[model samples]
Target chain A: MRDQPTGDQLLATARDLLREDVLPTLSGSQRHNALMIANAMSIAMRQLQSGDEPERRELAALGKILPLPESHGLALQQALTEANRALCRLIREGRADSGQTRDQVRALLLETTRQRVAISNPKYLG
Target chain B: MMEETLRQALAAFIAKETGAAEARISEAKLLTGGAVQENWKVQVDITGGAYAGVLDAVIRTDSASGGVAVSHNRAEEYALLKAAFAAGVTVPEPLWLCADKAVIGRPFFVMLCIAGTAAGHLLVKDARYGGDRVQLAERLGMELARIHSIRPPRPDLAFLEWYEEAPALHSVGRFRRYLDSHAIPHPALEWGLRWLERNAPPRGDIVLSHRDFRTGNYMVDENGLTGILDWEFAGWSDPLEDIGWFCAKCWRFGAKGREAGGIGEREDFYRGYEKISGRRLDRQLVHYWEVMAHAAWAIIAIQQAERHVSGEETSLMLALTGHIAPELEYEILTMTEPV
Candidate 1:
């Protein structure tokens, strides 16, 4: 649906320009700022490349434990946020402390957190 | 003219405080790397007084937005520094505190400027500083022991509220309350808090814990540590809390191999601490608090991100700090989960 230079591609190019071309010329705090900008651009590019898969997967995982409505009229992000809130409530209530439920919760948290790390800083995962 | 005015004001204040006939402050320059506070370096020349000598000192004041919710104010921090200094901890000598706002438009304190690099990444990587990592780690442990020697039930630190619950539980409750106030839910962090609450060890002797006693909070010259810095987050808690925080994997930066603040082995640091404290540490509790360390850092990272996200303060560093939450969450999960 988009043009040749896609969102991810655009971000990747911008990051390259700042990290490789412009960063060498800068110094001190300016260099630090440029590096941070480059890091943000990289993260944005990864998020775009990964798309909504991480969110959808997380929601599907959350739906397993909670009685999520089949036809709840909400956008994906909103639904995901609500599902996470429910999960947090379950954790606080100590409902996720048992055998099977604890395992399920742990798995979901690990996968979702890993996905976020993939976008934020994959080096940490490695 | 503004610089001249500040110089004159500072010189006058120093003269009055130190009983110097003449005091001149020169090369008053602001230092970097304190997100919540401003540190200004100044050279003071004193004449005809007991303190008649050239001195390098640091003037610390709140930034425009002040500090975090849990930290001490300037006056309290000055008192804490003096206490720590008296306790024989390797801290900067607290010289004077100016509470009068008219002096610098905000409350500020001055301490003897310590010489060393407090940069975390550089300290971990550059062998120039941490070449003799064993000695450095041991010295750090000894310094921490000195800090832990200062107990509570004192008039000077009466402002610090004595928690009814165990210190670990108290911290978990605090973090949970903060999360409740936020717009979004942190399920990962909630899980961490739940785990921490469920498995918290029994209450130990509540000594003064350097809450932020991590690699980045201290300084290191080539010879070794010059002085411990950033007592803003210091408080009364379990002694193991500081040790756990020192060895936490998150605090190790990228040098994960060297567990003690990415500087040396945990054995050496613990050995130094045990030598001075004369108490054996529960190694299991240290692990639990290491997990808690990540949780606490996650909460702090969230708050830092909120400062940017809420449009209160726009800083790239703060935003980036928030991005670190996922890694912290992953760490919490790894540490809490069974092998």
Candidate 2:
């Protein structure tokens, strides 16, 4: 059997197909749909290129800041998740009023969300 | 015949005293920009009710579910509309409010349909109407100032529970609450939230704030602004919030150079607001809230996109709304980053 294309090769092929073949044929709503799909695909491609290292780095950063017990992988994830949930709860209760309090919570939350940016696709940062 | 429903409701509620039955209802279509609420074009032909002629009206209702965190109920919206129309704010005249779910599957209200264009791009692009753009923008600013001057104290209007000492801080919290409710992760939006929290403007005098004050939210005629629609986000807050929101880049209708809804400069808008209210414009406060305005909108864009992805309400419009986040993020970065 022929060897399968690598992930990068597959993404390159998709990008080529979108620019050369798909986009030229699309019109009206179809054109809009094609552009949107292309955008999502480009983001997915970028995430693959970076691997999950960004997530791991962010998790390690979270482990340093938050109050998590010293287990490495899953514990870090759980701590990050708990921090996000706690912040969300505070926001829901409308308690994030003080500037310093809001700043601390937002810093923690931003760090957590930044780590997960790979899942949301980097091209979305455009 | 439930043909008498409109007639009877109007007679009992509106005091129009019509005994006619609606022979037919037609021309029904959904109006855009009411994600938390809905408006449907409702045309009725009355045969024997107290009213005898065909009438064009809009049926406003709660959405399948409330999409926004702080949307007022249908009855509350109707009351606010009636109060504003009575205060001469140029709104469609509210006719009747039906809280019963039997008639329309949800709480719904009816209002007289006013004829005017509400599309911002069409207003800016069509040369026939384009000449009136700057003048209309100024007039809109003046009219908004007039709206701000209205100080009704009815119980229905006094429901907002903003923090007494620090309204600006409370506003930031409310926006954060809205974002948290959706639970979608956005690094850029989180950054915006953090920026706004760190740079919160000091609270100023409170006024009746139309939370969504912008070009697409208003109706325009050949002369000027005819009415401001979408009062579901109305509440008591710092008036500069409305001013900053009106001048935000997101509402510029594709004309990035024109700050005032892509129709005029900031000077013209400020002059109109000041002339009408007799209050000097605070440039610094306006600029600060303008940043907050974009932050709030960024969260809203995320929520809209999430609605489509979550299978809550799937539509091309919702999907396009999600695309606006990139531009919003760029605005936030430029506004709050260290100089």
Candidate 3:
């Protein structure tokens, strides 16, 4: 429904401007600030490209062991946050100490964490 | 004239401390890029005093937003520096401590300035600085052993709280307490901390640890290390904690091949440490502490990010640091298998 230049495309273009043009003109702390801005913009662009699929996948994974409420009215980010907290509670109660539940909890954590790292810093996954 | 007035007050204070007839401050410049402390480089010329010389000095004090509660205050840090200096550690000479806030709007301490760069990003890649990497690492280890030589039950360092519980558990409790205040939960941190609590080694080899003894915290000239800097995070803990923190993959700054702080082989550093401490280290136990090191860094990264997120401080660097936690969390998970 949106226009041709999407959020991700706009950020990618802006970051290109910063890295290609503005970065060469700066020095010292100003250069460092510009680099950080470019890096942050790149991260935003990557996240936008990935969209909400990762969070949805994480929520479905969390629902495997922990019972999910049918038709729970919440946004994707909020739902993931609440579900993750519940999983943390389960982990602290020693549910993830041994047996199949432990394996399941670790799998979800690893899968979801890898997805997050991929978004934040994909080179880390490599 | 306001700057002149402050300079006069500072010069008068220096004169009294150095027993000089008059101390003339030629230059007083504030250094940048410290969140917790403010360092002012003051050039003082002493006239008719026991310490009569042209001195390049640095005066350190708390920032406008006073230092975080965890670090030592100005006087305590000065005492720590003196203790390290006395113990044969390479450190700047602690000259004088001013407790009277009237002198500089905050209590401060003065020390002789040393020349060197402490930036990890540069030190790791550029061999021109820090000389031979192997000797630099060995020297760092020896310096650490000297710092660990100072034991507890001292009236001077009485400000450091002694803990009956294992240092590992103490850190876990602290991480948990801090996470409780955070808006969102950190499941990976909780899971990793659980592993730490379960596998914590008994409190036996307790020694003073330079909690932030990584590549960036210390300064090194082209020849070798000039001085071990940033004594704020020093505390009593297992000596291996420092070793583990030093060797953690996260501290390596992209040079993951070289283990000893991305500078040299771990064996050389350990050899220097063993020579000084007269004790062998358990290399296996250091693995657990390495995982803990990642967890500790992740916690600190969160703290930095929160400082920016809460509007307490607006810093792009701080915001970026928060993003580093996932990689650390991944490391923690990789190291601590559920089996």
**Best DockQ among the predictions, by candidate number:** 1
- TM-score, predicted candidate 2 vs. hidden true structure: 0.74
Classify candidate 1 by CAPRI docking class. high
lDDT of 1 by residue, A1-126 (tens): 878899899999888888889999999879988999999888889989998987887888898989775537899988877788889999999999988999999898989899989999999988
**Fraction of the true interface contacts (Cα pairs closer than 8 Å across chains) found in each model:** 0.92, 0.00, 0.75
lDDT of 2 by residue, A52-80 (tens): 67656655654544454444555545655
Q: What digit string (tens of lDDT, one per residue) describes model 1 on residues B1-339? A: 227887898889898898999999867887853657878898999987768999899988876577776788888899889889999999889999999989978898989999888989999889898448899999888889989999988689876768867888999999989998998788988999999999988787999888899898898788888888888888889888888889999999799999999989898999889899998777877899899899988999999999999987888889899999999999998889778
Residue B308 C-alpha lDDT in model 1? 94
CAPRI grade of model 2:
incorrect
Model 1 regions lying over 4 Å from their true place: A69-71, B33-35
User: Candidate 2: where is the Cα deviation over 4 Å?
Assistant: A1-42, A45-71, A74-126, B1-23, B30-38, B47-52, B66-69, B120-131, B177-202, B221-224, B305-330
On a 0 to 1 DockQ scale, where is model 1? 0.89
Q: State the weakest 10-residue window (summed lDDT) of model 3 chain B.
A: B1-10
lDDT, candidate 2, at B200: 69
The candidate 1 chain A region of ten consecutive residues with least summed lDDT is: A64-73
lDDT per residue, candidate 2, B61-152, as tens digits? 77767656667888888988987787667788887888887655678888988778877787656646534766776777787887788664
